[model samples]
Target chain A: MLSLSSQFPILVAIAPLMTAPICALFRGKAAPWAITTIASAFAFYISLQLLLTVASSGPISYELGGWAPPWGIEYVVDLLSGFMLVLISGVSTGVLLFARESITKEVPTSQLGLFFAAYLLALTGMLGICITGDAFNVFVFLEIMSLSSYALIAMGERTDRRALTAAFQYLIIGTVGATFYLIGVGLIYMMTGTLNIADIAARFPEIEGTRPILAAVGFIVIGLAIKLALFPFHVWLPNGYTYAPSIITAFFAGTATKVSVYLLIRYIFTVFGVDYSFEGLELTDILLPLAVLGFLSMSAVAIYQSNLKRLLAYSSVAQIGYIILGLALANETGLTASIVHIFNHAIVKTGLFLSVGCMFFVVGSTYLKDLEGIGRRMPITTFGFVLGGLGLIGVPLTPGFISKWYLVVAALEKGSVIGYGIVALLMISSLLAVIYIWRVVEVAYFREMPEGTVKEEAPISLLVPTWLFILGSFYFGIETSFNVGIAKAAAAFLMGGA
Target chain B: MSFGFFNYWVFIILLMIGLYTVMSRSNLVKKMIGLSLFQISVFLFYISMGKVSGGTAPIVVDGPLDTAAPIYSNPLPHVLILTAIVVGIATTALGLSLVVRIRESFGTIDEEEILEMKDGA
Candidate 1:
């Protein structure tokens, strides 16, 4: 038999993929949750090992069924993919820890088994996307993630019927997006006659300026933009996040769009290469304007939301704008900022949503008015929310500040007037972030508690995992070596300098 | 366009019709029909690409060891679409089920009515 370490790459994906069906089969109350948590923990451990192994040795390529690459499926774990695997699985494990208590309250007891089953399927899909090296496999995994999420989102109908509408709307938009991506992949395959990502990149130089290749790039970028929720195509995000079960919202907030961002990075930087994407197609000119408008307008829109979840949902979109802006900058620092923010934002946003879940657990509402004086009643949960809010505002010693700092430095390195303008735009958006987060603080801390309100905290089961993420973000912010070091290495690898 | 590119024209036209229906319709079931149509158009596009000008089925014959090998059409796209088709069915089923639940809860499946109720709430 092969050594266990030799199989870490595939095991990272298979643990969750294989466990999902078992989760569905178990009818016991706690069996499914136990299975999900254990599977996620296993996947997280393997991913961490994979990341360390890649960082120390080199990229690991595992062939499925002993079939060679460019023919059979292959799984590759490099610095970027390894980092993403750890991020996705790590967040999944943390969120699953909190899920037992939160899901118990929100989802019906009969549906709990199937609920965790879908969660595991979504986790498997995301991990598969990070590890797969084939273009067609990406589309397959993308569908897996999307279909499972639709069911998970619709499960929220038990709380509010609007979730059904939200899930349906997302289903329509998401299917169109995935189909567009498949068309793009088909066009590329027609020209290159290979579905392997590395093989396509190798053959691209010869067919660099061909019409089909250009169209493929156009279709692929647009499709991923929709999936990434880049500004104009982000209509499906806010409602979907707002109406989903709180824990599901937190889970998807952390992993789903970030995976799409990863695919975009892989396609642009690895498959198409920098010269073709930015200089040849002038993609920066398009992405820069959209990024600017996205952050500015979305932040402005966020400030008007009365529901705290809806407000943060809009902020997530605005944060995606910052990541895209970094990609548009197209420098080492810019890409580093983008890559690091993917980690930083996922941690911060997921923590924020979990804190909201904690509040909802106790008080049964997340509206600004309903959260009044919650700081006094639920001190631990409220404090966690405020700290996560500080991260959102890019305060010093928060992961958000580290990324925004890199962004400003990248803009300054441009040494052009447009660069200065982008710096100003970034500041204005952060200021908008302050306004929205402050609205929550004002309600939670300053407003008087309603009559007969008692001091009751969310149960420790939920609070512990919530603080695990909240404090974890703070730890990464101060240490900076783990997240930043990996991000820099990933940026270098993407820029083809490693 | 030449008759040689007829499949391309059909694919583009079907795609446009499906997309327009999805955008314009308010009834949830009709919207789902449109989505299935949209996905089916893509399946057609993929299947069309696998065809070779004068090739036979990809299966191997018994008496071809000494003679020239038979030309076979590409089979990869067909296999990929089979997976996509399964995904499409799942999406359609889930979407229809959600629509059923919406009708049960809200007493209507019209997009405008649902939005109006949400705003009033």
Candidate 2:
């Protein structure tokens, strides 16, 4: 028999993919949840192992069907992909733990199997995207992820009819985004005569500065920007996140757009190289201003949202701006900040959304008025939200602080007026985050509990997963070696490769 | 311009039409049709990229005699487009089904009407 370690790359994706249909076939209530959780746990374990292996032994390239690269599809697990795999699978497994109890409340019993099925398929798609080494394969896996998410979001129709419209809107926007990406890839393939990412990168030196390549870069950047929800193209994100089922919101809040960010980073740093993207094409000129505007504007918008879910959704778009801002910095430290924030933000946001899910479980609503004095009723869950909010505000002793610290240092490395200006923008954005997060804090703690409402907490199943993420973010914050070290190494690798 | 560039011109025109329809039209069904058209335009673009002038389909006959191998078109793009076509069909089906559900709940598939209802609600 082939050694299990030898197949870790494919196993990370196949574990969920193979189980999704089985989960769907089992129409029972508990079985589908059990199967999904087990599959996600298996994938998470493999991803952790793969990350450790890659960190120790260096990047591993697995040729599918025993065929070599540039001819057959390959799966490459370097430090970045490994770190993302762990983040995606770990968050998925954590979210699945809460899904059993939370999903039952929102989704009908008859649909639970199908819901988990879609969840696994989405997981498969995400893992596939992270693992694949081919450009076209990324698009296929992207559609898989997008289609499954569209269906999963629509499943929220039982809770709110707007979910239908929201999913429909996302479908249109997301498909257009994916198609744009396809057009870019096709143009690149036409020029380079290869689909493999490494092969394309190798061919770029000979065909540099060509018009078709320039057009391809524009198409790819715009497509990924839409997927990344970097301010202007974020029209579909808030509503989709707000109306999706609580568990889905929590799960996707952690994974979906982050995967798109991963793809964008791969294209920018790995496939196209930094010089071509930043210096030749001057992508930084465009991304820097947009990133600054995105965070400032989206954070301001978040401050006025009365619906807590919608508020957090807007906050998510703002946070994506922070990640993009790091990319725009075009320094190793800045890239490290972006990579680390992807992990940090995913954990903290998932935790905050899970806390909201918990409140929804008890209060049956996520509006600020419904959450009044929630701190007194569900203190553990509300406390989790407060800590997560502090993280968003970049308070010391939080993961957000680490990301912002690195971002500031990276900006100062420029030692120019523009850099200092960006530093100021970052600070202002953090303050805006504080304002929006404090809105929830005020309503939860300062306001009195509605009369005759008893002090009932969300069930233990939900609270445990919520606190796990909350506490995990703090643990990562204090023990920066895991997140920061991997991020720095990945950044150095990308810089060296370029 | 040579006729060799004709396919790309068709691609640009179809792409613009498809994108404009998806953006301008409020009917969800029409939007799906537009999406299909957009996807089909890309498929045509890919197929055109694979075309080898004066070459035949990429198939090998049993007659393996002393004759030189015949020129054949690049089959990879065709295979890639097949997968994209499958994805396109799936997207269209999903989009149409969502429109049906929207019609069922909101009583109309017009984007403006749905938004008006949402606002009223």
Candidate 3:
């Protein structure tokens, strides 16, 4: 018999998957909602178990069907994935806490069961992506996740028929991305003759200097960049996030791109080994500039967007730039900043988007013009938005500041002209965030309401969960031990390998 | 090694053709076809990688105890591509369904008209 501890990694994925079909078969909101919440809660528990085990005893590797590696699949859970699992599952559980009412309003009643089922399956796909130790397995789970996401986004047609175009656009682009990744995997297999990630890494050293390997790196990086909505490839995010059901906006803003970022980190640092990718390939020279441009340009676009959801979506691409900037830095502190920023940004964006969901719940529109004077109308909800905004701006004592501080420190440690130049660019982008965030606060708080507008608070269901996200953001900002400790260890592990 | 990489060239051409269709075409159904083509090219690439010059089927023939070696094509890539093919079909199905819904809601499947309507909205 497998010990419970030994089974925790797979259990984290299976819990939600097993419940997804059951949730789909039920009718109405409550039963499906209950099933989803219970499944996510159980997955969160398993993630916690995995985190504790990895924290105490280092990484855990589980082989499928009792088969050995290089032949059968493996699931590897180390500190980095452990941290991400906790964040993904924990935030998903938090979202499911109050999303039922929001979902009921956004989707037709008969389809609510299918909505929650897709949500749970998407969760399963992301967790599978995080835990798998094989390259090809990532492609399989990515398709599962992408297919469900297409369904979930299209279901937003009840609220806005435009969601169909958004879903279709995403489908085309996302398929190309996944197929490119598959091609990369096929090339790697041809060269290394192994499917397991560690096995490939073991074999890579002998075969490192080759054209196929370099091309594989290029394809995989581009593929994942498109998937994660890195700028220039981010055409799908704004429309997709804006038109989707508000609950999905919050859920995906927290998890999906973050998982892709985790995949990039794993492939770069673990599979190809950093020395081969960064130094030999000079990828830092390429990615650093893209990160800088993405950060600057996307924030500028966010400031111009009239729709609140789309604005947040653009900001998400900017935040992805920050994460990629850290990864590109290729240092211990830089990797830590990247890792911790993944957690910090996930919560901050989750809180902000959940706040937008509250507005959509109350005001029936999230356009900036429609949101005039909503701060007074929904004071507590606006406060949560302000807190989330503060976190985004890297204001003192917010989690965003902690991440930005590490990034700046990492740049300065390089102590070269280009490094200092990057520091200046980072500062400029943070200031740009201040401008966009201020526009919302100004319009919501100080702008006049139209003559007939009514004022009221959002329901406690939405308010409470939104508050939990903001509160957790501040809590982690204040107590950095848990997030930073694991992050620093992961950073050391990557840099040590480099 | 004279024509060892001929299969990769075929994959490259097929991939480019599919990508061009997805990018240049404006019809929703055409885009989905392009996506399937792109994915199918990848399937071809993986399946081709399993080919061995002198090998027969991967299945073992009747064997003696440690006699002469029997050459066989690598079977793992074929297995992996089977999964990929299934995923490709699922993606195509989902894409087509989304297009149906789009047609129902927008009264057209032309990408330009849909975007024009969205902007007009």
What level of docking quality does candidate 1 show? Answer: medium
Task: State the lDDT of candidate 1 residue by residue for A1-498, as single tens digits.
Answer: 899999888888788889898899888578899999999999999999999999999999999889999998989999999999999999999998898878888898888889999999999999999999999999989999999999999888877777888888899999888988988999999999999998999998889889989889988999999998999899999989998999899999999999999999999899999988888898999998999999999999999999989999999999999999999898889999999999999999999999999999988887888889999999999999999999988999999999999999999997699999999999999999999998888888899999999999999999999999999999989999999999998998889731
Model 3: per-residue lDDT, tens digit, B1-121?
Answer: 7378888788888999999999999998998888888889888899889999898888877879789878899999999999998998899999998888888888888988877874411
Off by over 4 Å in 3: B118-121
How does each model score on lDDT? 0.92, 0.93, 0.90
Overall local distance difference test of candidate 3: 0.90
What does chain B score (TM) in every candidate?
Answer: 0.93, 0.92, 0.91
Candidate 1 residue-wise lDDT at A38: 98
Best by lDDT: 2
TM-score of every candidate relative to the true structure: 0.98, 0.99, 0.98
- Report the error of model 3 at residue A433, Å: 0.6
DockQ values for all predictions? 0.69, 0.64, 0.73
| Clashing residue pairs for model 3 | none
Candidate structures ordered by lDDT, highest first: 2, 1, 3
Clash totals for all candidate models: 0, 0, 0
